[model samples]
Target: MAWPTGASPYGIGVRDAVVRGVGPRSTDGVIRVWYPAHVPSSLAARRYFDGPDELQIMTRGLGWLLSARGVRALGGWRTRGHTNAPPAAGRLPVVFFSHGFTGFVGQNTHLCERLAAAGYLVISIAYPEAAASICAPDGSSNVMSAAQRRRLVGDQFARAMVRLLRARSIDAENRAISEVTAVDTLARENDRWSVHLTAMLDALVPIDQRRARVDTATAAILDAGDWSRVALMGMSFGGSTSANVAHLDERARAAINLDGMQQGDILLGQDIRVPLLVMSSAGSMLPSGRVVNDLHYESRRTATGRVQRVLVADAGHYAFSDLVAFGARRTRGLLDLGTVDPERMLTLVADTVTAFLGDALEPGGDSGTDETEVSP
Candidate 1:
């Protein structure tokens, strides 16, 4: 379970730092920012939630699983020949990442690291309630109740529907039932957590206020002139979050959804001005036909008319995240959770994501390419 290694490129440097206080959560939220270390550029750091202890516990849970599978941090990937940091004056493009429900921000370390190696500033945010963050002297703690745990699992199913709805247009009867079922299921699952997720959304005195706070704070840190472009990405629940954020946030120039289910107003088809990229696991049990239709609908209706869909052959729902291999090995009964070959699966995800991000965020930059088969 060694951490996956990234391929380094010439003239590009990489470094990472954890930024605190970007969200409203009580805990000090972190934004792991990665960028080319050779330039003298300043970039705004992206932020996410700061509250919800359950999310932190979930992150730890995933980490424990990874560690059990032998995935230790191998340190940062700095170019051996290039010791000087990149100019800090020039801003690099920015990309924000959200993890799957009950997932830690670093679950997709392979993909984030590869994007960093390609000369971009990538920020992966941990949604407090949605992520699995662990805290304990020995790292053996379950912060969520049995019900909360179930909601976390159910959130995945809800997101699957969101992706499905977005790709295809539903017929009159199907649309009504799909929307009602999706909303009803989500509400039922949220109730299990005492409707914590719903409460957060409802508590926003003025819905726009929440958006304003996040926007103001993020804009201040991320206003680097060189980082002129921005993108959003997520997995599972994170993917749904990305779609929601992209729909509402004008700052995002594009978005990528990696096998996440969508919920709430996000599924109703809001206007998306930027490009949208949808990636899915070819072997997932979720309905691909529905997802394809939603994607087609969004692309055709959106102002940009730019939407791309890709399927990773033989990949499972967890293949896009670091959880696939790590979870399988660590959790005794989780073998059937994802594809068996973890390293290869990670490589495929990393390569595809890097290429897609490069093309979307840094149009002029060299978009590196890699070809690898998806393994189950």
Candidate 2:
């Protein structure tokens, strides 16, 4: 689906590149970057999880038992800037992006690209730890958890996701979801990803800290001298991590959770001094989803700065993903990307994200940049 770039004074250009030093997975895990690229070469967008015989993998993998194809790139690859492209005139806000469980760094490119266009340097990290698998640039892929696959596999599971996502009866949906037990799964993964916030910040910011193995070559590409303008954002499981991590990490200026359910430490209680934006699918914001998210939002609202919650009407758990637009509309794949007007949802999600980030990071910027600015 085509997402819009708002009429900001800054013209938007994009380039996707990779960085390592986070973990030991040369292809196991890598950080993906979507920065402002004024002039980029037209390189064909390549697939990290789609092909079996390619040379290397630049991202994470999400799929069912049969297919491992990550969301296929539908020709926005021109954003891949040449190595060491110039940063926009000034130091832009640095946004740390974490994708949902079993999702690639590019899983939420629609949002990342939009944020980049709005003058933010968005970086996403994908690892095989919480994902089904990660692939090498040589096209050789490996599975991280056969157990995760078993838990998510089968016609029964797909129907469960579809029912929980598309069910008319909220009670039935809640029961089905409870039976599945993915919330615990999500929370654990969120914790795994969240703990890395300090490490991620250590690498991105110019501060001297004992860091993960710094990917010196890739680190050179980053120009983030301003540690004050940092934010954490993620979708689904990633969203949960953003919320929990924002509470745990002192450096996060703000955090946004896009339709991710709260569990684990967030439920036990966490501190929050950072502004948080929690967005949910209108449909799934009920029963357990609402119960957890509302409590988290309200608690954080009291503990810290602003905690804004908005619902994307006519959307589902997967609405924040590109799967709905690029992948098949139906629940044909491993993920039940429910049917929504992909274009409309993308527009709504992107607009809300841009506004929220602007309000939180920009000095003298009003919080009116939120969903209130975007007509329902």
Candidate 3:
């Protein structure tokens, strides 16, 4: 992808590959990793899992689709470029990126690429049964039924089953679960789903056995003395996942949640010790904005001391993801989305997130800036 104009003082690097040993979830999906590449260094970054063959084929297919749509919508298809490694004397900070519900890691490549360019090693995980894996080369092995393939997985399936049964009791129960469910349940589900999601992450572990094994990979990477800091970020449900991860993962120094609803104990129970930043939609902050208000209130109450919340003037939740301008443009209207210029929205998110991480993780980095001011 094209680096935003202006060279990064630390320079930038890019690498992409399918993490193996991960998917094929009933449908087999592979996780993709984009990290700061360090070549000719004494220590080589290991490659984790070799995803199942079917999964690799599936990834290629999805990649093609995304590339086509992205080019048509974004004006150009940006290719990944190469850069020099970080000074061997120090290690780079690490950032884990989680995608929205039913979204793959590649969906937010634009944002993740920007973070990578800004001198951080970024790993984006693709959740199984939650992402669109490519179909096999012969156009075979794509097995998800039409219903299962829909973006809104469980809810759609539940509604269809309820309608087919014509069972009022079932319908009522589903509605109650939807209405009365606690946000903590959502957070717990995020953790639970991660159990399966870890497979995709396995691909990032270098193939070498000496450094560490798959089980201890994440810990090993986080504990590296060379790593100056660590941060977690996500959008929508992924944003909520980041909150849960930050609350539990002591290694996480900070977190950024992009328009995700707060659920479970994250809001009602646990205290967030690390610095937290919440970016929401301006429309969602208006009189009828329960999601934004509830999250803002809960975050304020739970944050120990450091917390920041801002509503992008004309942006919507999807603004943080590529869906607004990359996918079917019609999808934008489906959310009753507000009109934030796409380029401005992307820059606002990138700059705000960079500033947040800089202040919280970088030693002596500037942190006092408030809302990032972008012209309409």
Candidate 4:
């Protein structure tokens, strides 16, 4: 439950808002936004898991003793952001974050805090339907979707999808994946999340009065964001969401997917022209023992865009998330976190992502920060 001590100078501020999506395919959405802010020394930082619903989601309904212990540990941890603090001066770049499937909004709070400290407005979107659980300020928790819950616990549909992910080649993967109509469910879900991402963008549009209402704090924070310089980033299924949103939204100058297997129509010949950096752990292997970049390889081969790939050494699937820093100590066997030091992994990930986004969104690029650098 430890948080990363980031190097940025700006104090962080966070606020949450629920907005109804204006898109025909969109749904009501919850977003937690972190931004650079002015904080007084006397301000008290908020708890990591602040309320009942968040605590329930984090502890998985407090079903296991280990989980309860983890929650107790988390209770002592504090976030870097002050709730609804004054926004820092100057319009900053915007970056949207999506969480993995079955993950709640704050799953990657460490990364979001790091980005917010680095002077970007970071909006972490919550997909209540697909998330393990998401508690809104209104005291309602949207639990996991029954269909997605079945998929997670290994129904026939889930097994078939896993088999497709292990296919030896793109053609083989695509051919097999096409036979399953249920794959459309992923496409539909991706569309929903992507639409939610765009809806957040719509909220920032100064003239979009027809969209959801923005509160005073939300308005001030959104106003400080330079929407023209926007990027998308996420972990796990959230990573897949980032890639798909970048492909569909022309405003996305760059995207980073942290170790998620690709899903959605992005695998079915849709070209992504945005600059994308796909970071992988050392362990994404196919059935034939070849360690592949999965969608990264396919995007590099056919997509007319700047695509860079990096594989972190001694890392596992969950290493890109905050789960590595906290729950890994107790749930290591279940979560399969990488062997790298949690703090070091968090620093490496934050540095790499910050460097990439700085170069992609800022003028003249981020001087000499090595976007490809990784720690041993």
Best by TM-score: 4
**Residue 374 miss distance in model 3 (angstroms):** 7.6
Task: Give the per-residue lDDT of model 3 (tens digit) for 1-376.
Answer: 2334334543334333333344533234333334444445453322111134534543433444344343243333343434223322236677778777655655666677676656677766655545554332233334233354453435644554344334245444334334423334343456665554344334333334313423343333323323447677888777777776676666667778888765444444345656778787764442333333343324345345556677776776777776555444565665435577666777777888887887888763423324432335
How many collisions per candidate?
A: 43, 11, 20, 1
| Candidate 4 pairs with clashing backbones | 1-326
What TM-score, computed on C-alpha atoms, does each candidate reach? 0.63, 0.73, 0.66, 0.84
In the range 1-376, model 4's lDDT, one tens digit per residue, is 4466767778988887766544332224677899999998888887787655667655763234235777667645788878888889878898989888777677778888988998899988877567766666666566665465656443545766676666877667655555432465565666777776676666665435413365565766787878788888888878877887787778777788898766654544444656677787766655553334443324335345356666776788877877677664557656777677888888888887887788778763422212242447
For candidate 2, lDDT tens digit of each residue in 1-376?
A: 3354455544344333333465665654456666665444453333323343321232223334224343234322333223345555657788988877666666676677677767787777765566545554444456555566454356655665666666566567656555444444444555566666556666567544313334443444355434578889998878877877777677777888888876454434344556678777754555444433554544444554477767665566776876656555434233444555777777777887787888888764424313321224
Ranking by TM-score: 4, 2, 3, 1
* Candidate 4: regions farther than 4 A off: 21-27, 51-53, 56-66, 145-147, 152-182, 210-212, 267-271, 287-305, 328-330, 363-376
Q: Provide the overall lDDT of each model, using Cα atoms, as 2-decimal numbers.
A: 0.50, 0.59, 0.53, 0.70
lDDT of 1: 0.50
Tens-place lDDT per residue, model 1, 256-368, is 77876554544355445556666766543333344432522152443444566666666667767765654434452352335447677777677777767667666543222
What does candidate 2 score on TM?
Answer: 0.73
- In TM-score terms, candidate 3 sits at 0.66
